[model samples]
Target: MEYNLEVINLTKNYQDFHLQQINIKLPKGKIIGLIGENGSGKTTTIKSILNLMTYDKGNIKIFGKDSRNLTKQEREKIGVVLDDSFFSPILNVNDINKLMKDFYSNWNEKFYYETIKKFKIPDNKPLKEFSSGMKMKIKVLCAIAHEPKLLILDEPTNGLDPIFRYEIVELFNNFVSNGENSILMTTHITSDLEHLADEVIFINDGNIILDVLKDKIDSEYGIVELLENNFNNIKKEDYLKCLKYKNEWYILVNPKYEFQKKYPKLKVRKPNLEELMLLLVKGE
Candidate 1:
């Protein structure tokens, strides 16, 4: 299988934080959701992959080319939507369009206008005047207007209302329908990942804790509340993670069916992305 992006033993350090020995494999034609709390190195990993910052160790490859060595043309094949990066807020839709046209040889003018009109974004209004949701919509539009093969987004749906979020999700669905494009989006909004992501990578404190298919999460992974005595009956390797609240224990168990067959009495329920993150990140 071909991968769109690969990070091998990537590491970066700061006075208080360290992105330690991170490895990721993002396959083509899939949406991989990166989930973590603030200061968990999601943005740091994305920045390193884009070569926006230097890493102390490891390698990053995009579209089979070394990320640091990507040519201008190779770099153009990736679209990026950073939470805190964009054209000047004083620039309007038209100004951005004009700038992107000159910057990207593959910029699609027709698609740009079509997306703007479809989203009812004013072509003449400055980005500073737009609401947060509208501003995010514009950012997404700019990222995809060039029709890149890979889209990397950080918190793209952070402040959007449900309606706008739904529209943006639909647009993402359409973008990847061709089966050649892929997206790596990091968001605190796990509800979107619950529905859209093919797989999820959960990062906490600079380490990747969980990497699993969304389908398996829905079908085979589950959480069970067990008493201390019952919890002791299960082996550490049998479950992914465990948390204790009061006298009850919440354990994240994979292959829920097998677990159920073994216990036959405990109730195992499927976990949403947020619950899974809490269990692994905060649990023992």
Candidate 2:
């Protein structure tokens, strides 16, 4: 039951936005997918975890040590891939390799080069000249070159093609196969989470709204579409959330099997991650 990262009562406030007391736990050897709409505080939470920004109140623990007090050696055990952070675009593969060698004591140059060759990334091209997908691949490679135990990534698959995204997903699967490493990633692509994540945390308006196992999302949660009259017939206590679309209504119900038993013809079905988020965020 060891956790790789824990956020306890984390809170940050701004003039127009507030990240309320947030709590998250990333267990070792698991992939936790953080999901939310744009400007919903996904990036803010990540920045706070990385100590890139200060929070008003909370405790963040990484590897059981206060994140703020992590030693240089301890910091090296974590890899980070931020959507807007990277080495200067002018730097090429060799330059980055040279810089990383000085930055991390365990930099794996051989493995880095092998990965570069496997991905067909040019060794001499500047990052500025690479496409978004290429740049993303390089960033991921750089993050893992140091052989870290935990990876924190923001929007790692934002602009990749299906083929590349599949490859990256496979790479992530391989990363945790050893049962010692873990990854925390944020992406708008919930489908990827359906295939890769062990747990999913949904954040909205700077607050965590739902945290559950990926399997439970399918096995225990259900979605029902019906007309307003039929929707009103269902007891409020039986469903978690509901949304209205013109003449139709969608309800998110837990323990769908029971709901199905009650309304046998209601067409209750499991929700995909995206549908679940939509109902949670926009449903009343």
Candidate 3:
């Protein structure tokens, strides 16, 4: 019933871009997907929550404690995977496993080796000799084998094949099924989120465009296509974004009863996550 992580009024200013007043609540036993374009402050937000970067304003809490106040034991309960891995390239998989066993208080040696076997990762080969996908698999294995309460990942399945992506997502599903763990992942691949995320947070240009349950997306939001003649009749306030191309107006709107009553003849249809994302980011 409690949130695993809370980000409130988060803001950070830079010379060229700003992460402004972002907020999110990630409940335990749920996976929340974060989607945004490159340089849209997705990584910045994650880093801010991890306290890897200094923020100018707002509070970030994990497991009911301010992130900065977490003890070594508390910090160990968070398993993280960034866009890049931090393991030394010269270290082989066996070496990494040995290091991890010593680092985490409750490291599961059985689970770690099982994961390596499942992933088909070579224990004797150094990371530098592995492909990007292989290295990513190792990182994922390391994160999950520790049995953390929360997993924060960025682009965790970037280079994997479709089958493995599904497997990894299945792992996420299993991780949260017990209602004791949760995950917050930022991914450019909306399809992955569509399959795994219970809720989604869409950010654009450092601002939150959407943050809602995935099921509510279809029921509450839609795209409306209007003929050229009717385009001028629709009010701008009704739609979140609009575009005029090929003599038709494409608009995304909440489809409230009032808007539908006003234009019963308008064509409104449900959009999938990827389509909706595109309309919001590129429609205007």
Q: For each candidate, what TM-score against the reference?
A: 0.93, 0.96, 0.91
lDDT for every model? 0.91, 0.93, 0.88
TM-score of 2: 0.96
Cα lDDT of candidate 3 equals 0.88
The window of 10 residues in a row where model 2 has the poorest summed lDDT is 261-270
Per residue, candidate 1 scores C-alpha lDDT tens digits across 191-262 of: 998878999999999998888899989999999999999999988977888999899999999889988888
Candidate 2 structure quality by residue, lDDT tens digits, 41-125: 9999999999999999999999988999999999999999999889999999999999999999999999999999999999888
What's the C-alpha lDDT at position 137 in model 3? 88
User: How well does candidate 3 match the true structure in TM-score terms?
Assistant: 0.91
Full candidate order by TM-score, most accurate first: 2, 1, 3
Could you give candidate 3's per-residue lDDT for residues 1-284 as a string of tens digits? 79999999999999999899999899999999999899989999999989999999999999989999999899889999888747889999889889998899998889988888988999998999998888888888888888899999989998888988989999999999999899999999889988899999989999998888998886888778888778888888878888776887878888545567777887778767887788888887
- Model 1, which residues run further than 4 Å from truth? 226-239, 244-249
